[model samples]
Target: MKTDLYLDMDHLLLLLLLSSGLQAEGSLNQTDFVRLVDGNSLCSGRLEVKSDQSNQSWSSVCEDDFDQQDAEVVCRELGCGAPSVLQGALYGEGEAPMWTKEFQCGGNESALLDCRSSGSDRNTCSPGRAVGLTCSEPVRLVGGDSRCAGTLELKHEGEWRPVGESVDEWTLEEADFACRELDCGSAVSVRRQESSDRSVWSISYDCVQSGSLRECAASDNSSHWLNLTCSDFVRLVDGNSLCSGRLEVKSDQSNQRWSSVCEDDFDQQDAEVVCRELGCGAPSVLQGALYGEGEAPMWTKEFQCGGDESALLDCRSSGSDRNTCSPGRAVGLTCSEPESFRLMGGDSRCAGTLELKHEGEWRPVFDDYPFWILEEADIACRELYCGSAVSMRREESSHRSVWSISYDCVQYGSLRGCAASSYSSTILLSIICSGLLLQPKISASSSMDGVSEAKQQGLLVFRGSDFTVSCSIQPQYPGGSFELRFTSSTSAHTYTQPAVNHSAHFLFPAAEPAHQGSYSCVYHVHVFSHDFSSESRQLSLIVVDPRSDQIINNPSKIIITVVVLILLVSTASYFYFKQKDVTVPPTVGSVDLQHVQSW
Candidate 1:
């Protein structure tokens, strides 16, 4: 019977392969039985077993049976490099029908099913108990200050080590291919260097000018390591200067295309990182698709930076699956050099007494200077990238006979363009300017709109629940108006409020399917007849349906639930019948032989 079952299983597996268009030409490989799920790349995601019963069905593989040897076969069969890391349920849980068989791979098996197995079958498995893996990239850079410039490392036998003999033989074209593979621009410098203290691997490469480094001819040899430096890949386009324009990042894939970044997701912190990476000063202004809209394939990840990261890729960002941004929202940035003049003796850079620079000497202006006006102060603040002038005042104290220079800026040009006053004074001038440092906070509630007593909190809501979104601005200005906008996958809606209130509210009668998405607010005010707007960070609202107890309606769940119930009933029936035949017979004295026989 066991021999017959084995033959039946092999026949079934062959039929599955033929029906799925997979040729049954040779021994079964790992790709024929193993697959990845829920990841952006083939090298990532939860591991699952392709059921021999059908191509459409799969069972989650257990991490308990996973090891480096198993991962090696999986990666090799998938046409990827060796496995860099293996994780247990790190990518998230899988649906039922987990594979319970334990594999004992010898690290040389071509297929997972060909390896020795314990043949254990389990009725149930713990949730989130699946295997995950991150395969090593074929080419990488190492031992450098930045990811772009580093010692070239190649993957051999699931490990990344410095190239050995091929170091002297490597050409500029080969180095360029390596740099492009890592998406770090073209190779600027390639030189032979002494190997590090770490172990070195013997590898030879015959790379061509075209194609990726992975496509190069490779062999084993022993020699020195190669160090390389790649030029900065990021660039600004369609602006007056290189440091001011639309932001586009080069793709690390084989196509080597460039993609624009979405301004709606790019924030000031992200802008700072980009400027610093490009050798530019801090960002003066970040515009949203200002130059012009881009084409398709815009980056949608929201970059989160701590204002100190060396590379934009080093900062934490949203997952690549979030492709919510369109070409119309491409990001633009204007970076500026640090200001020559600075404020002193005040709480902050924007609200301090003013100082001037002249002839390489620091001096102060007259407090009672006749030409002092808001326009001049505005230019000074603009030079510092501190928004506009909020207030200007005189700081009175005992006289210090330092040199003073006055400027008359009549609502035009930079502070340096203003003409200096002929006279000098000992008194100092003090001014306070509105800074771009403030960011508004957004909150949501289930209560009625415009209710001051209700506290704003988390955004979790049920379907058909009435909700209100409010945005509160700091350092309120009388002429500033608030605009609230809501965006979903298909459409967007906006609401506006006049300048009378510092806080704005948008009331929804009930949470509809269309109303679920991201929301943000902007504060705009007219300064010198020109409008300036400050935008807030985006907030996401998730609406759950109480009737279904799910965030959204999924049609597949119904079928899965029915299938699970049927399997449970079949297993229970089989166990019950098997136990009935093995039950002990009742004693003759009990006088229940007829009843026992009937049961």
Candidate 2:
């Protein structure tokens, strides 16, 4: 009938086991729990009716044991199940619970000795006839025990009730017994009365000595039973008059009290939440007591959700992080106020208004929204470095969102020269192709000053003069400052200087034995001013001595090397000295080396 009962009950019991299926002999299982509600009965008029089977009801185990009868009782009440059968279901406190102890009640659900039923109902056991079978002497038991409330069957009324005083009928001996049973401090005083009708017994004992109260000692007669009352604490009928819920120690009592302070009251932290979400109200938590005693102390809750008040619910995080793992609320010592922004053009990417993002989501950036503002989002979104924002303007027409600001970086060239995007501003797209695409043509040539005999020169030159490759590079930028470097496959190569601006040239070392063989040549150059340097176009050179027999073996490469060498040598001589020396002598018929040169 009441939905929240189960909800609360489930919450209370989920942490505890409902029952145990251990050995039925020594072990006990609380498969169900039951509680009593007034106006309970097995009748149609008092019942709620429903067609759905799930709407069935039940009664306590004290009511009936037969399944069919129980069903009838449940049907009559229109409840899910019988209350008595489910009288002692398992339950515990807190999120994770541990069930302790068995049922502690006098009803059928409890493990207490069943003594309430009559005669043959429980094998014909009559309590009154069982002479002198009473509770333990000095029934000063814990608050949870049956002896907690003294047990006395009054002779006059023939009914069981806690000992108390009534003027019409009572006795001092009975009162003394009551005191003795209750363990009250002492028989400090007494009250006597006459009895005739014998319908009920009247006796009283005062644990707390206030007036001429019937203060009688139930147990430990010397010690007073401070402030204890019968009708107040335990009833002769239902017990637990002082408290009705499960008896639990005040465990973690101090911390529980602290946590409960202002738990449902207006939270001061709410203001911090407001500040975090809306961004404008950048206030910290108002700690300490608030309206009531210990009410509304606060801690700073954090998140990047946004600066809008709507952000409060989830305003702790920003960007994709908000989408991941429920960026619920962040807690912090302090937080910065979110700035605000608005976009102008239709092509703007975000959802309507512009947002300053941090952590995860967007927050309002401070709106100095003008034509060309310094807002980072503005620069990134509009894709422009028209440097040093020109102007700023707020769009008055758009109000569903806030106003927007624009910016213009000073023109650095094209978009390629100045990278940009709505989400990033640090990227640079300087694609200036200043590097010269060059072909390094290196040539090496060697010659004996006056020797030239194609075949003979090729065959004999290596034995006579060592070959050299004077690698001279033509200027992609003529006369450009350049390093004349060389990387030979086999030689320890060196360069004069880097080709600054462009062309480069290097003279091979005078000559080498390996010069007759093929060797690789490489030149390195700087391609971009902002970028890394470029590698030179490599051209292989085959050196042929002026007198080498292998002249035509690699003639083309040789000629190329020779030409490059000639150019380098000529250029070097042209720059180094005014002119090369030369001498001429008279000759006749060119055949007198043996006869004429003897002198």
Candidate 3:
């Protein structure tokens, strides 16, 4: 019987492996393709390769043969900046089909295929020899609320170093070059660093307006750091309209400095402020660094807005904490106008698949785009004046006409500002919205009887006990249904039931650790063929282990009761003795009755 059980388990494991459909050894299909896997960013990952007729598969490369030049080629080919770290198997080991070929790159090759390679078979390489890399961004801004304005850091020798302090007088010409190098509009102001921080002044550079910073002469003198501020300018990039596109800002007018705002610090209120600042109406949609990643300098400051602020700078900011902005979190915005996008074919006007109107034709948005997130859903719901997004789903496109454009919304803003491009896909997104008026109230009880005891008992249950959670709608609407949802830190479970007289109950037969979580219910009803939903207040349930209850309630309760009785008796004895000692000192009128009783 033991042998049979082992064989059954082996069979199940084999079935799982087969069902996964992982490629076989050396079965890659792309002949001239390269990609990174299992790493956090585009620059860092385990390297993989493929040739024509073979699918892209994990392959091994010798660490000795892989150099910084070869890694730079790979980074450039992948549209990344430069190589930071190149190590074999640093990301993880690869499978079969090791590329034992000897590669030689000159560090300037546009594609990895352009580099010279000595053909060799996979047999020469050993296991765990796959190459991994970390790439450095070409440019970045530091220490500012806007991306276009900040202390500039440039990548040199695979390390990020601040530009050298000016030996000659620092001029606006050099500052203009730096701003132009970052693709920002133009230079606004140039200022010298007041403090002599040697760490930041490791290298000093003398630059001219026509040449790149790399061509500038370097010195070892540790003096002041050069800080450049670009002009106070704002523009929308990568969109068709002047009011829409990726949002870029320049904070300082004296030192014209600009930087991309991070999505982490942006929201709908911020979008509204940006629109008003740009002389536009309210924003229709807002997205986070979806159009494209900005250079290193990001606006790390957090903005606090009430959605009525006229300017972004007028809102409160998190001062001096610029580290909150991370790479690839730039903000995007799309302002409300006559020619924007809308939702169609949902349970209500507020809920449905996204559609953009262009050239007098409505086009469907493809759901397969990777950038769709909760922030995008929130922006969409808000655009429709809906309360909030309850759920987002992908479904097959009902119509044959697909929108030629794709959007990326990382955080809040107008959807029009999201980077748009031509794309094709068969699936489309469907969004569901819940208005504010439909919020439901949920209660947990020990039993389903009309008189629930759990409410008085704080909704606490012992392990192995049974409990019930009920949701009721006040001034209940007819033809509504209830959907119960349970959510814990790690997992979520959902159940649905038809509402009986405006109430629905969920039962848990045996409470356990898995059942300990906050539960909520939604009351969904169809009115005028539109779906309306109300969510209940969250009900938290706590389940105590039986052993813990025993330890806390049994011997501990007995000890407490015994101690209380002893204290009571001692107090009574003390009072009696005190009365006995005061016999002769009583007042004459008051003591006569006591003396007659004694006689």
Tens digits of per-residue lDDT, candidate 3, 1-599, equal 00111222322343355468765554322224578787755456887755332343446566655777888888777655656557677898756456656667778977665566654334565556678776544566678677667777666445566665553434443555565555554444455455555544233223343344544535345455666665335655565444576877765554444568888777888788777765456787787765676553565567788888766767887776666665566887887644457778754566778786533457776643454766677767776678677777778854666543223422423444332322557677777666534467777755323345333323555567688888887653476789999898879999999988888888888878788777888888875355677786677666655454321222343443444455455556656667787433232212221111111
Which is the leading candidate under lDDT?
Answer: 1
Q: In angstroms, how far off is 362's CA in candidate 2?
A: 32
Per-candidate Cα lDDT values, in order, are 0.62, 0.28, 0.60
Off by over 4 Å in 3: 1-232, 235-275, 278-350, 353-414, 418-441, 445-457, 460-468, 473-497, 506-599
Tell me the tens digit of each residue's lDDT in model 2 across 1-599. 11111222322233233243233322222222222232222111111111111322332232121123333333222222122222112121112111111112223322111111221222232221211111212123233233322334322212232333332122222233334334331121222223232332233322222211222312111111221212111111111111111111111322211111112222344444444422223443332222222221222222333333433334342232122111212221222223322232321122123333322334332232133333443343343222222223333332232211222221211111111112222221111222223445444333443322211212222334443433334443233233334445555554455453443334444444444433333445432222222343333333344444334344354544554455455555544443434322232113322221111
Across residues 1-599, which tens digit of lDDT does each residue of candidate 1 receive? Answer: 01111223654566578568786555354466777788545556788876544444687877776678888877766656567557788777777468766666667876666565554555565666688876644666778977777777766555666765443244444555566556565444556676445566543333333333444435554445777776555666675443567887764444345678887778888889888775456898887877776563676567788889986778887775565775467888887743436787764576677765532456665533455777777877877778888777666756474433334222422332222322344456677777833666677666422333223223545568787878777764456777888888789988898745577777888887777787888888765234567788777666656566455533444543444455456556656666777543332112211221111
lDDT of 1 at 145: 78
Give one clash count per candidate, in the order shown.
2, 97, 44
lDDT of 2 at 163: 33
- The runs of at least 3 residues in candidate 2 whose Cα sits more than 4 Å from the true structure, single-residue gaps closed, are 1-439, 447-491, 498-502, 508-510, 516-532, 537-599
Question: What's the distance in Å from true for residue 550, model 2?
Answer: 7.3
